[model samples]
Target: MSTKIAACAGAATLAAALAAPAFAGPAYTNDTGGSFRWYGQFNPSFQSFDDGQEDFNRLTDNAASNSRIGFWLEQAYGENTLRFNFETAFGFRSSDGVNQLSTGDNVSWDRTNIRHVDFQFDTARYGRFSAGQGSMATDGITGADFSGTGLGASNAVADSAGGYAFRTSAGALSGVDIGDAFSDLDGGRLGRVRYDTPELAGFTLSTSYGTDVLKDANDRESYDIAVRWANEDAAGFALDSGIGASWTEETGKADQRDISGSFAVLHKATGLSLNLAAGERDIAGTYAYAKLGYKADLIAAGSTAFSVDYYDGSDMVTAGDSAESWGVAAVQKIDALNVETYLAYRDYSYADTSAATYQDANVILAGARWKF
Candidate 1:
């Protein structure tokens, strides 16, 4: 193995060896049956990148799931309940934010790091209503995955080393980044008001309208609707799926529309799973992703999971462009320590009919996540 790979493996081993015990902190309760709790997780990774012409390595906060903290409060009123949530990231240097030209660490807290600040009310008979700076109705609709290795490999292939520029066949920078070519067209969080219907026969409906709240430069308004279903059978098979459509428009600007969905299935008896996702944008073209995974109690401490995934996208950054990526990952869960150690390898390639041919890029990531 290369020195970089060896270093990453050693770090992962050390992290697992020193894993701390799980702790959720104290949950305070009131006489009225109200409760409050705080929680968070730290996700750090060692990333090594080879962009055809050069190589770069860094220790960074995993963009797959950045370090974050949050608080939840809940109260019951007969058959109904009210809840509040506040969450934010730590604003650390991110794996995907560094590139050949900008390798220096950049870290600072900002409003953009705020993930959720919202209120929700749930009714047993009616449904659920939410208002806040949080997830839109379609958020994560295209990312459903039963694979335990999702922390390292998923539909979001760009999260691994997005900022790295692709090199042309002539060994020159193409001025285009990986993130521009490979997009999942997935929904994202925003300031919004949403409603979700009560589950009926394992299916539920949701909708939302929202706009940018933390960023001052955005003027678009967004709307979306989604449907989700989940079920488990006595035969030890489980399935989860969701589909959604969203639209965003800004005065005088061309409106954007997208449709996306994902499904995952697991066979408990065989510890085998399958995940599939697909999406299309009115202007950006389309993409599809798939992952095959297996999990088993290979160790006494916890389960070991392995997966391989692939992504293919077309016309993401510009018309006539194609992007493809593939990866393999493994994760080891330490149940007693609330920690997950992982190692992943991914390869990316892009092509454009209107531009010079580009060389492929490869990335290696090793990390650990600890939740409390």
Candidate 2:
């Protein structure tokens, strides 16, 4: 290689060597308790339809707001430190295959994009606080643990489990985007405050409250409160689980309520993991989730994983005939990229016989996401 090329290679290696420790995971590690990390990720996926019924044939297919990219920065300082997380996803999209374009085109995005943006600070003895437009604290974002980068069967559990409902209740103003936390699921103009207690052995607790400023004419929305307690790292077996609830105050009548809970267990020596999540949506609906997963590191990349999940909900909880569903998938990581994917089949049951709808629907998506 030329002298210039060798020089450039040397500089790149030196830079990576110097930057590695600053961005490693877990801000407070060991006695050092200080560092910074910066990382970005990109994921894009596509779909092909085989909708044999309803003349669902079309021209082109695109993944809509499914593509994403962004990065995060975190640092620790003594008993107190600072952290910043910024991320965004493809805002909105339209599909082009067999009339699917109409479905994708209507999904408009106003202020919501995928790059989740937020910053956090630790008050040490006081509390840890987070601010900015970031992930919704609703039951789903806080409780749902579906492995994929997309929403899945976890919603059924989050909505029905009573203590972990995925934040899909009242603040729902249909006039906005799809994923906004307060408006739709896309994005919302809101702020959140979270406080966590220091852990005692394998136990800790947390509570969070949030709402959108533009929600009410005064730009003030209802306050959603969440509480979680977990027990873990006991004996040599590790386990973590907790429950939470959210309530919205109405002007006159009783308040709307959502509650949810989840638990995970790991047999460290055997590499076995199991999880269960449940949610309840007021008097309107219910949700439950059951899953089993295994981790084995015999391969070159060290570890591989597999899992299965099932969920059931009330009639109004999910649309159609059965309101019951299940999904399964696996993941393998090699070097800079890990390939993971999942597909779920939903059976929607109907309460009214006079309705016309697709009795059974299926969704399948699989792809790879890379980070650097």
Off by over 4 Å in 2: 1-37, 48-78, 92-110, 114-117, 135-189, 213-220, 230-232, 249-255, 317-322, 336-358
What would the TM-scores of all predictions be?
A: 0.96, 0.64
lDDT of 1 by residue, 1-372 (tens): 378678878777765655464567578999997999998988888889998888888888889999899999999999899999999999988888888888655577899999999999999998999999999999999888878997789999999899889999999888789878877888899999999999999999999999999998888799999999998773698899999999999878889999999999999898999999999999777999999999999999899999999999998888888899999999999888889999999999998886498899999999888888
Which stretch of 10 consecutive residues in model 2 shows the poorest summed lDDT?
176-185
Summarize candidate 2's per-residue lDDT along 1-372 as a digit string, tens digits.
143234433432332233233232332334455444444433332222222222121211123224344555656676777877766554434221112224444335544453356787876776667776654344332343423212223433211111111211232212211111111111122556655666555444555566654234433344444444444455766666666666655455556566667766677777676677766657455556677666676577535666677665542433331345555545544443332222222222222222333233233333333444
True-structure Cα RMSD, model 1: 1.6
User: In model 1, where do residues sit more than 4 Å from their true spots?
Assistant: 1-3, 15-23, 104-106, 251-253
Q: How accurate is candidate 2 locally (lDDT)?
A: 0.43
Candidate 1's C-alpha lDDT? Answer: 0.90
Q: Largest lDDT belongs to which candidate?
A: 1
